[model samples]
Target chain A: MQEELIRKHRWFWAWADDREEAWLREMAQQGLHLGKAAPLGEYFFVRGEPRDDVYRLDYVPMSKKDEHYYQLFKDAGWEHVGEMMGWQYWRKLATDSQADEIFTDNDSKIQKYQRLLAILTIFLPVLIINVTNMGVFSLREKYPWIIGLQVFSIFLLVFYSVVLLRILFRIRMLRRR
Target chain B: MAGSDVRKYLPLTESTYYILVALSEPMHGYGVMQKVEKLSEGTVTIGPGTLYGAFGTLEKAGLIRMVKEEERRKSYLLTARGRAVLKEQITRLAIMNRNGQGLLGILD
Candidate 1:
């Protein structure tokens, strides 16, 4: 039989990885399994018989270059589905015990979100430079389109800042537990 | 030895304690996971993320070191410092258990 493939345009924020995992697991339950994931929320899934599969995403920026990283997960009964950016996609058979969580402890879960926050921090300076150097007021008359673009960029900068703060709060909350 | 230096890492978290105990003999990440589960009688199951992060933290703290690599699977063993920390944690737990057990008689 030929392979049936489907593409989905769903976007998830940095803090919504758990939601993404749940959505992928839900898709698997409906006989659609995630295949290749592209940037900008593009996901390719292959049609297959519905099965109980638990999907997990781990944010490990440095592990992409390490062979042992993938091997470790593979040895632990998780299949390396694919990677979107630095997030590693893994799937395992859902057992009756529901013990397939990628992070078993609050500290490790906090570390995962910290890694994400670190990445976003790296981009913050570049966005700030663009917003300041571009000078929306100066470009408002000569280059009106540039002003609109600047406003959109500022919006994105604010959005990311809020996300970064939320992740920080989450880490703090985890640490308090 | 730096007893005070290693004491901070003492009272190892349940996952870290199990991981350290499992690495008493050299073992890889997956091996550690399986051994921990077996040793804990399925009460403690360390996931990949927790295991990986634990390995890195332990290695950095000079408690564990990579002993060898087999087919890209890095095997780790507890260092002398690691063994000391584990012993200290076990001692603490033993004391706690004795006290708790004594109280159980009174409560009953």
Candidate 2:
């Protein structure tokens, strides 16, 4: 048997973690298993025989320093595959009886999205400050590089705002359920 | 805590109630999950994500505390405040159950 490593590209916003999980499960069904996930939307996969596996992602920001956190998941029968940018990747065999859901209730599911929203909230103000500085201080005229930085900050601000809104909507939807 | 204050946390959700009951004795995260499942007869299952998030919230609310760590797993048990809240919730649930059963008998 030989190991085949492939890099796959996928963009997943914080609120769309379920989409990323679905994509990973689809890859597993096609005999490509995720090995390592890197920063900036790159996923490394190893080729293997097709199998039914359930992939789940949990936004655990401080889990890198929390051994007990990972151990709990491990003891619950989830295999810790890897961590990329505060997201923990876990997989378990697709079984016949129980459904594969990391959150059993709506309250906990809302909490997960709230955590993601919190992260976006933190960066939002910083991006706003950058945009304001460029506009008010006239830095774009003094420094040519400031123009590029301003444009990048504006893009990030829009992206973060969209993600934040989606997460808030998810929390509201969970509460209604 | 006063009875009224403890009442604020009453009507614990199914998952939270099972978790608090399981933590009546010292147990870690995974232990709580297993005990809850057994106590509910497989009717309720707390997944890792829910369990982890609940631990943080309950601990912050002074309802639970970490007792010790064995091999990377941390054991937790209810605090005095937790017991007070749980007791209040049980009282509320008992009243609700009695009313429901009485209404059911009338319907029958």
Candidate 3:
């Protein structure tokens, strides 16, 4: 028999990972364990007995998914929940002997943010180049919709810059600790 | 690699320290985690994330290299540089231990 799954929609910012973890843990406490997260901001959960579970969101650095990476985490007992937008969701039932946290030291945590920064640095430039290559300025005279595309591209450039800055600030704060 | 190169990784993190020590024999990620816990007598625990990240950084620095891969698990062994780095760390730790022997003396 198929277990009925519950779906929920919510959004989280890159800097608000702790908030995301809290919200997911709360969902687990209410017996709605995460089954999969897909299509962005949509969380599918499997209804089960209410229990304490810890959720962690990890950003894998490489563009390609490494099975070895998952296997290592499995070795340490973190069950892979689902991934959305390159952030891996890991769940571990709360236990006295097992560790609740995923990354142990500040250096590893800093490296996580560093990996995110690397992705942004790679994509942000590609996006700008692609937008410019679209000839938005020249095409706008013939195609008015090109102006809207230009505006959206500019907005994304700014959004990417802001997110980059926020992550840099977060890394600095972690170093201070 | 002793004068400055080895000292660059001096004062290794507890996890890194235990990891290098454990990799005296090639071991996989899960093996390293279990060995670290035992070596530290349950005091220092290396979660998978830290260990995996350390493997990347260490491998990149030529301090550790993957010697075997099987069943989706890669086993790593310390390089000559890794051994030098570990020795430098031990020297510093030994000095600290000697200078702070009062605690051990008092306890004994």
Whole-model lDDT values for every prediction: 0.87, 0.86, 0.88
lDDT of 1 by residue, A1-177 (tens): 877779999988777788999899999999999999988999999998998899999987863358887888888889999888888899998984536887899989999998888877999999999888777564556687777788888898998889998888888978999
Residue pairs clashing, model 1: none
* Residues B1-108 of candidate 2: C-alpha lDDT, one tens digit per residue: 347678788778999999999999999999999999999999999998899889989999999999999998989999999999888888878889998987996796
Off by more than 4 A, model 2: A96-99, A137-149, B105-108
| Candidate 3 or 2, higher lDDT | 3
Poorest 10 consecutive residues of model 1 chain B by lDDT? Answer: B1-10
Ranking by lDDT: 3, 1, 2
Q: How would you encode candidate 3's per-residue C-alpha lDDT over A1-177 as one tens digit per residue? A: 899889999988787788999999999999999999986689999999997999999998556479899999998888998888789999998874548878889999999898888887988878788678666564747676776777787788888889999999999999999
* Per-prediction TM-score: 0.94, 0.91, 0.89
Candidate 3 colliding pairs: none
What residue pairs are clashing in model 2? none
CAPRI band for model 1: medium
Flag the better candidate by TM-score, 1 or 3: 1
